[model samples]
Target: MTHGGGGALYLLLILILVSIPVTLIWLFHGQGNARKRRAIGFSQIAIFAIAIILFFSGVSYLQNIGFVAGFIVLIAMLITPVVFKNRV
Candidate 1:
């Protein structure tokens, strides 16, 4: 819960890691669907914010693991569309 420079940097890294794949998805599949992409992006941002808040708010270890597992599943789902573009 230290609000130091390191904490800010950690958050920035988390934001970047979460945003990169979403940005790629936005650039590719979101070609004509601006509104949809915007909504998806906002939701991702919100999810990341919630995860960080939970992390800093002294959430239990099991809950944190569950959150991370859910995040990984979400990322996998997002990547699936890109990987199998024709099917999606």
Candidate 2:
């Protein structure tokens, strides 16, 4: 009946997953935005989704890779809009 930090980590991932779309809508909203920019904006959602799927799967190496990838995607999420903003 005692679960340690698993629930907390799950919540963290859920927060991250939710933040991606929120950030996309908030940061990228404007007239004359390009489809390419929108694609880049939404890629974080796909990245985190795959990361979570891989992280939870049975393959140990994939889980580690996914864990690392998730963090990398988090950083990219912060940086991506800035990088792509000039094109919008």
C-alpha lDDT score of every prediction, in listed order: 0.55, 0.69
What is the C-alpha lDDT profile of model 1 across 1-88, one tens digit per residue?
3345345445455645765676556645565555655655556556655665655556567445545644654565366446544422
Model 1: ten consecutive residues of lowest lDDT: 79-88
Writing each residue's lDDT as its tens digit, candidate 2 over 1-88 gives 1256356567567758766765576456734566766676667778888998998888878877777788778767766666655656
Report lDDT (Cα) of residue 74, candidate 1. Answer: 51
lDDT of 1: 0.55
TM-score of each: 0.48, 0.66
